[model samples]
Structures are given as structure tokens and as C-alpha cells.
Target: MNGVSEVFSTILLTSIFLALVFMLLPFSYYTIMGSVAKTEYEYVKHGFYSIATYFPMIATGGEYSIDFPSQYTSRGYIETGRIDIYLNSSSQPTLSFPCMALTQGASVGGAPRGLLYGVDTYIVNDSRMIPRIYEYRDGNGLMIMTLDTCRLLLDVNIVPTGNYSGYYYVLTYYNLTISFRGSGSLRIEPVRMYTVYSNIGGNLWNITIVVSDYILGKSFSYSVIDLVKMGFGKEYAGIPFSLTIVVEELVVEV
Candidate 1:
């Protein structure tokens, strides 16, 4: 009878142990998955920050590359993403391009948040009444004057002349948007850049910078006169002038 009692006690203990493991299984799995997702999110965010911080360099038609992990978690995968550039206080974007990012499996902390970078405003003072047409590359188009911290690309067929001219200074206002996605690694480069000029008023002009790529198929615009007020004249010490709106699409390869 004692041997039978001992056998029963061993069976009961084994049952309890198995039940405890089953109860903890889900908690352990979720905890591990959450940690993994967070780490993946951080990696993507860092890649975006690097692109934003060195955007000027990349804008000069250079290649920027980053490693994009295929999966955030066992179930989460990357989808389409994009980057947008807003100049000044305008509600619309002056420049935009396609990017990639994770878009599924919300149970594992959802997708990463988008990134925003504020660009400093600089006054570009050109002594000539007609803005100097910088050097034109063999095939790259016109390379505009480089600011204190950034370079601008503009393609102009009609250069301002006569009364519509004076010492001009352009106020630089810009911002950036970055998103992510894909498997293995990715390379981003500017495929094309061009600008169109329109005479909106006597002294005020509309400049549109258009960038195009495979994934981008939209256009957006905003006026500079609404953001900052200034006059144009050779008599004034440093008259603010010229509104530049940039629209761009880029090639991103995996």
C-alpha cells in the first residue's frame, strides 16, 4: 500500500510541473518577441537618422546605403515607405521620394515612428542683379550656388534681366521625412534633378525643383511669399528674394 501511495504522489508532482510550464509559455514567448521587435525598430531608426543628418551630401548625387533586415519579428515584415521635404511653414511638400518600412504585425509593438529633421534657414546674398548661373555639368544640368551648409540644384532656361533684377538674397527653409523597409541591404541615389522657373510677378518668381523616380508619381507645391516677407531692389541693403519649391523622386535598390 505504501509503494502505491508513493507512485501516486510522484504522478501528482509531475502533473503540477507540466501545468506550470504550460502557463508560462506564452508569457516567455511574448517577452522575447517584444524585445526583438524593439531592437529592430531602433536599427531602422538609426539608419534614417544617418540619412537625414547627411542629406546634403546625398543630395549632391551620391549613393547612400543601409542594411534593412527582412523581418522585424517572426510575423512582422517590411512594406513600402517614403521621405518628404517641406520648405518653411508650407502645408505641402516641396520634395518627396520613395523609401521602405515595416508595416505588419502590430501585436509586436507595431511599426516604428516616422522621422522629422529641421533645416536651418540661411540668407543667400547674390551681388548680381541677375542671379549667377553656376557651372553647368556635361550631363548633370545646372549646379546652383552652394549655401553655407547646403547645395541647391536648379535648371533655369530664362534668367532674370533688366528692371526685374537687383541684389538678391534667398531664404533657405527646408525639412526632411524618412521611412524604411526591405530585406538584406538598400542603396539610395538621385537619378535626376531639374528646376522650372516661372515669372509670377514683377520681381517675384516661382521656382520648382522636380525629382522623379520609379515609385514616386505625385506632385506638391507651396509658395515662399506666404512664409516670409521681403522686398526686391538694388537700392535696399539686402532685399530678400526668390521662392524655390523642390519636388524629387529617387531610385532605391535592394
Candidate 2:
């Protein structure tokens, strides 16, 4: 009887020990898996954090593009004056990109003088500045002096808006050239002209303008007199000074 009782007690203790180990095995596995998942989450968050700070610096240089990991899906858009990038739902986004403008180069030639650098624009704006105008008086009242007595060339760049990734160039120039000589008399009148050309996007464009000395009304009186004479007088029979130009737009695909 004593031997049987000891065997029974030993068997009971062994069974209890085995059951406890079985329960603890599952708990141990769960704890280790939880720690690994937390570590992976932190790594992904750190990667996105680094990207947010790096984007601003690259944007200033030019257009920036990048591809994300294949396992996750992402989306990018500009909203409320900022660019937002969203990665997978589980990961924090690499977001908040700075707004960047598309840029273009503008160049103006002074005929024989060559290309002027100081007046050029690396990035386009709403209103651009043209080449400097140097005026002097001779026997001919006022005239637009040219480079090496040549004509004036104006090169304009129509900068793209939004995400248009392409190359575009618009070239316009005045064919007329003026030489200041004591013999020539300055004509006080309004000069009207227009430039017609296609844009990089293959669209027709016409720009009409009236050139006059607004500061000195001297030409205004002449313009009025000419208008009166146009009714009957020969002085205003023909358009005093007018120019019209048309050209196919110069587009370079890059």
C-alpha cells in the first residue's frame, strides 16, 4: 500500500509540472513576438521622419521624385499650400513636403553686345524684367538704341505652372533698329506694335501694345492732332507707326 501511494503522488507531481510548462510556453512566445512587432514599427516610423526633413532641401534645387517600398501603397497630392504624402495605414507618413514652383530660364540679347547675365532670371515669376534700356538724345528726338546699331532681341520663357514637366521657350524680337544721328529729328508720336507666336503647348498667342512717352505728353498732342487730321487732313491719313509680327512658337521637348 505505501509503495502504491508514493507512486501515485509522484505521478500527480509530474502531471502538474508538465501542465504548467505547456501554459508558460504560449505566454513566452507571445511576449517575444510582441517585442519584435514593436521594434519593426519603430524602424518604419524613423524612416518616414528622416524623409520629411530631407525633402525640403531637395525641392529647392529642382523637381524631386522618389518611389516607395513595393509592399506598401502610397499617394501624393498638394493640398492647402502643402504637399502631403501618405504611406500605408500602419506606418506614419513621410509627409508635409514644401510647395515648389516650376522654373524657367529667360535670356535677352542686345544684338552685338551679347547675352546679359545680371538681368536674366533663373526662376520665373508673375512679372519678369526685360533687358535694360539706355536712352540718349541726338538730332532725332528719341530712339531705341540697338546693340552695335543692330536690332533688339527679347527671349521670353513661359514658365510652366503646376506639375508640367517639360521644356518650353518663347522667342520674340523687334526687327526695327534706330541709329542716333544729328540729322534725324525725334518724331513725337505713339508707336503701336504687336507680337504673334505659338506657345510651347502648341497654342497661338497675340500681344498688342502701344508705345508712347507717358511722362512727356509731347507725343500725346501730336497723337491728337494726327487723329483730327485722319478725318480729312493728309497728316493722319495713314497709321503713323505700326508693326505686326507672326511666328510659329519655338518649342524644345526635353
Candidate 3:
């Protein structure tokens, strides 16, 4: 009888231990996977910040590539995700063409995640109206885009108008779509730039930059004064004058 009782007690303890482990298995797996996903998200965010910081150094037709993580644990498998750029105009922006960065499968707890650069309003003169980038929404997900002073000047060339006393500014807008896929190298290049100008009033001209992304089938326009406020041109003190502006286009590939 004593030997049988001892055997029964051992069996009961073993059953309880296995049951506890079975119950905790799912919780443990999720905790570890969630941690891994968060780490991957941070890594990607840092990569984007670095790119935005040095984006201006890349010249027209120049390309920059970044490697993404091999696996996104949150998605329950390894796959490539995408990074999107959006014009963030929730409020007035102080930077020249401010943008935000949004990523797919990089969120925690269903909360929105993105990066915002060049937030200092004091960096440029205040403009009457700040131009906004065309908003692009991916389902119910948020989109983000960012542009810095250097990046803004990458395609802009300012020259002295020999015929006139004022300066001539050439602003280029690249209208292209970038599709970044999983764990692969993502490449970015200023493929093409187009410029358009219209005289709004006296010295104040409505310089519109129309950018199109064919892959997304959408296009939007914003003013050029956003550049002027960044010290792109001088404010004329005398009467409002006009100059003969020429529109130009250049095409390149990734």
C-alpha cells in the first residue's frame, strides 16, 4: 500500500508540472516574439533617421540603398515590408517641405509609429501659408514623410540672373514611386525633377511643384515659397518685378 501511494503522488506532481508548462507555453512564445518585433522596429527606425540626416548629400541621379531585417516576427513569418513617405501637415510646418516616415508591420499594440525630422520652426522665416504634400493612406494605417534643408537643396540651383538684378532659382521636384520589399535592399534615387511657375500677384509668385507617383496613381502640388523662406532667394524691396521663367525636366532610373 505504501509503495502504491508513493507512485500515485509522483504521478500527480508530474501531471501538474506538465499542465503548468502547457498553460505558459503560449504566453512565453508571445512575449519573446513581441520583444523581437520591437527590436526590429527600432532598428529600422534608426536606419531611416540616418538616411534622412544624409539624404541631401545624394545628388541628382544618385542612389542610396538600405538593408531591412530578414524577419518580421510579428507577422508570424519572414517577409519583406515597405516604407512610405507622407507629407505631414497636421499643423504648420517650419521646415521646407516637411514629411513623415511610416512603415508596415512595425507597430506595437496597434499604435501608430513614425519618425518626424526638422521640426524647428525658427530655422526658416515664417511663411503666410505652408504647402502640404499630398496625403497617401494605406488602409487605416498612418503615413509619414520627412525632408531636411540639405535634401531640399539637392536639386535646387540658385544663380544670378545676369539680365536682371534679382536671382533666378531653379527648383526640381522628383515625381516617382518607390516600392521597398521584404528583407531586400531598398534603393532611392532622384530619378526626375520638373518645375512649374505661375505669377500669383506682384512679387509673390505661385510656384507649384507637381509630383506624381504612378505606382500609387496619385499626384499633388505645393508652393515654392516654402523654399524662399529657407533663404533660397532675396526679397525685393522695390516694385514687384517678373522674370521669364523656363520649365525643365530630367529623367533617370534606379
What residue runs in model 2 are displaced by over 4 Å at the alpha carbon? 1-3, 61-254
Badly placed stretches (over 4 Å) of model 3 are 73-102, 107-115, 120-164, 174-176, 180-183, 198-229, 232-254
The CA lDDT at 89 in model 3 is: 32
Counting only residues 3 or more apart in sequence or on different chains, how many pairs clash (N, Cα, C under 3 Å) in candidate 3?
9
- Best-fitting candidate, scored by TM-score: 3
Q: Is candidate 2 or candidate 3 better by TM-score?
A: 3
- Candidate 1: C-alpha RMSD to true structure equals 13.1
Relative to the true structure, candidate 2 reaches a TM of 0.25
- Compute each candidate's TM-score over C-alphas: 0.51, 0.25, 0.55
Clash total of candidate 2? 3
Q: Per-residue CA lDDT of candidate 1, range 66-184, in tens?
A: 77554652212121223344544335655544432322222234322221322221122321111111111112221111111122332222335676643333332122222344457
Cα error, residue 99 of model 2, in Å, equals 13
Which run of 10 residues does model 2 get worst, by summed lDDT? 100-109
Off by over 4 Å in 1: 73-107, 110-183, 200-248
Local accuracy of candidate 2 as per-residue lDDT tens digits, 10-92: 99999999999999999998776655544443343333333333432322232222222212211111111222222222143
